[model samples]
Target: MDAGLLAWGRAVKRRGGKIPPLWYFTDAARLADPLPVIRRLPRGLCGVVFRHDTAPGRLALGRRIAALCRERRLYLVVAGDARLAATLHAGLHLRGGRRGVLRLPCLVTASVHNAVELARARRAGAMLLFISPVNATKSHAGAQVLGAAGWRRLARLAPRGHRAALGGIDGRSIRALGQGCAAAGAIEAFYFNV
Candidate 1:
C-alpha cells in the first residue's frame, strides 16, 4: 500500500462518513503502466479516473485495466466514453458537453464548469463531479481557472457526496486544500500522489 492510500484508509476509518481520496490521471500519455499505478495504491483509495478519447482497440486495454482494478479492490472509471463506461464494471465519467447513452448501476461522474453544468451532470445521473481548472494549469493552456475560494463556494452547491477539485492541482496545493477540508470537514475524499 502506498502512503496516499494508507492515509486515506486511516482517515476513512476515523471518519466513517467521509469518502476515500481519489487520484485523477488526466494525462494518459504520461502514464506508462496503469496496472502498476493501480496496484501500488492501497486497497483503501477510492478509485482512479483515467481519461482518454475512445479509439479502436481501446476497449481491450480498458478491460485489462478494469480487471486489474477489481483484483486490487480499486475502482476504475473510463472518462468520456459511455460505451467503455458501460462495458467496464467500475465507474463512468462524462464531460458536461458530451452526449452518450449510459448503462445503469455503474458509478457516474462528470466534469462541470459551473453550477449550471453541475446541475446538468446531476440530472444526467452523475454521482461524482470533477470541477476543474481550479488553478492555472500548464496541461490545459488557456482554460478558465477557479482558485481555492471558488472551489469552496462551488462545493457548497454540489449535490453529490463526491466532488474533486482538478486542474493545476499538485502536491503542495493538495496539502493546503486537504488542511482546509480537514478543518471544515468538507471534503471527505482527496485524490493525489505524493
Candidate 2:
C-alpha cells in the first residue's frame, strides 16, 4: 500500500464520525513508556502527537514510536518537523512554520485557531486542519477558548474538507463533537487532550 495513503486512510478511519480519542503528550518524560498506555487504549484511542519541547533523544524516541505504529497499525503524528516526518513512517503535522518544506502529499495536518489561520492552512493545502482552544485549558491558563459553537463556526470558514478540533478537549467533549459536529466534511479527526 502507498505509505501516504495508508497513513491518511488510518487517520480517516480513526476520525470518521467516530470521534476517536487522541492523546498528545507534550511532556518529554512520557515518551519512555508511551506504548504501554497506547496499547491499552480502547477503540476510540486512535493515536498520539509528539510536541517539540527541547527534550533529549526525541529523534530516537520518535523513531521508536514510528516502529510501534507500524507494528500496531496505529497512527503517529510528528508535530513541527516536516522533514523528520517525511523521513520517518509517522505522519506529519505542521503547526507553525510552513516555509522551505516540500509538500509530500502525505497525511499532512496544520494548526488553525482562527479565520486567518484557517485561510492560511487552506492556502498551504494542508490535508487536515487542527483547530484548538475549544475549551479553557489548564496548561494555557487564562487563554481564550473557542468552545463548541465557535469551533464549528471557524471550521466552516476553512476549505470544503479540512478541519479538526484541538486544545482543551476531553473525552466527554469529544463525544459531543462526534455527535453533532458542524464541520461535517472537513473534521475528519479530533486530536483531543487525553
Candidate 3:
C-alpha cells in the first residue's frame, strides 16, 4: 500500500468509523489471481471488493478470499451477487443503479456515476457509495472522467463519511480530492506492486 493510503486509513480509524479507508477492487481480467494481493493488504483498516463477475469457480475464489479476510481482519464485499455474498457471510456491492434488496444482515454498498444513480443508491440503503472515474483510467476507456472538481461535486451529494472515490484513484489523487470521501477504492493502485 502507498504511504498516503496507509495514513488515510489510519486517520479514518482514529475517527471511529466502521468503514475502512482503503479498498481493493478485484478485476478478473486485470488480476487473474488476487489472493497474493489480498494477502498484502494492511490488516483491519482495508476492505476488499471481490468483483470477479464472470469468472468460473467464483464461489470457490470467494471462499478463499473470505477466509483470508477473516484471518487478516479486513472487510470483504462480493460484487453483484446477493446470494453469493450471503453464502460467504460478506457484504454486497451493487453495480451502478442496481437496487437489489438485502434480506440478510450485511453491509450494502453501491457504485454511482452520477447524481441520479447516487440518489437511487441512497434509496436502496447503500452504506457506502463508490463515485467512479475520478481520474483517467484504462478500465473504462472513453468513459467520462470526473476529475477532481467533478468528484468533489458528486461526493458532496452523498452524506458525509459514506462515500468512496474510485476509478483511477491513488494516494496522490486521494490527497487531491481534499478529503472528499471517507474511503478510497482502487484496482491498479493496489495491484501495481503485485
Candidate with the greatest lDDT versus the true structure: 3
Clashing pairs in 1: 21-190, 22-190, 22-191, 134-146
Cα RMSD to the true fold for all candidates: 4.8, 7.4, 1.4
User: Mind giving the per-residue lDDT tens digits that candidate 1 earns over 91-155?
Assistant: 77777724457665777767777888877887777766777667776557798777787876776
lDDT for each residue of candidate 2 in 130-165, tens digit (9 for 90 to 100): 777777765456978888888878777765345566
Where's the lowest-lDDT run of ten residues in candidate 3? 97-106
Off by over 4 Å in 3: none
Q: What is the C-alpha RMSD, rounded to one decimal, of candidate 3? A: 1.4
Ten-residue region with minimum lDDT total, candidate 1: 182-191
TM-score of model 2 vs. true structure: 0.71
Once superposed on the true structure, which residue ranges of model 1 sit more than 4 Å away at CA? 1-13, 17-19, 54-56, 97-99, 178-194
- What C-alpha lDDT does candidate 3 achieve relative to the native structure? 0.86
lDDT of the structure predicted as candidate 1: 0.60
The residue pairs that clash in candidate 2, if any, are: 162-186
Model 2 has an lDDT value of 0.56
Candidate 1: give its CA RMSD in angstroms: 4.8
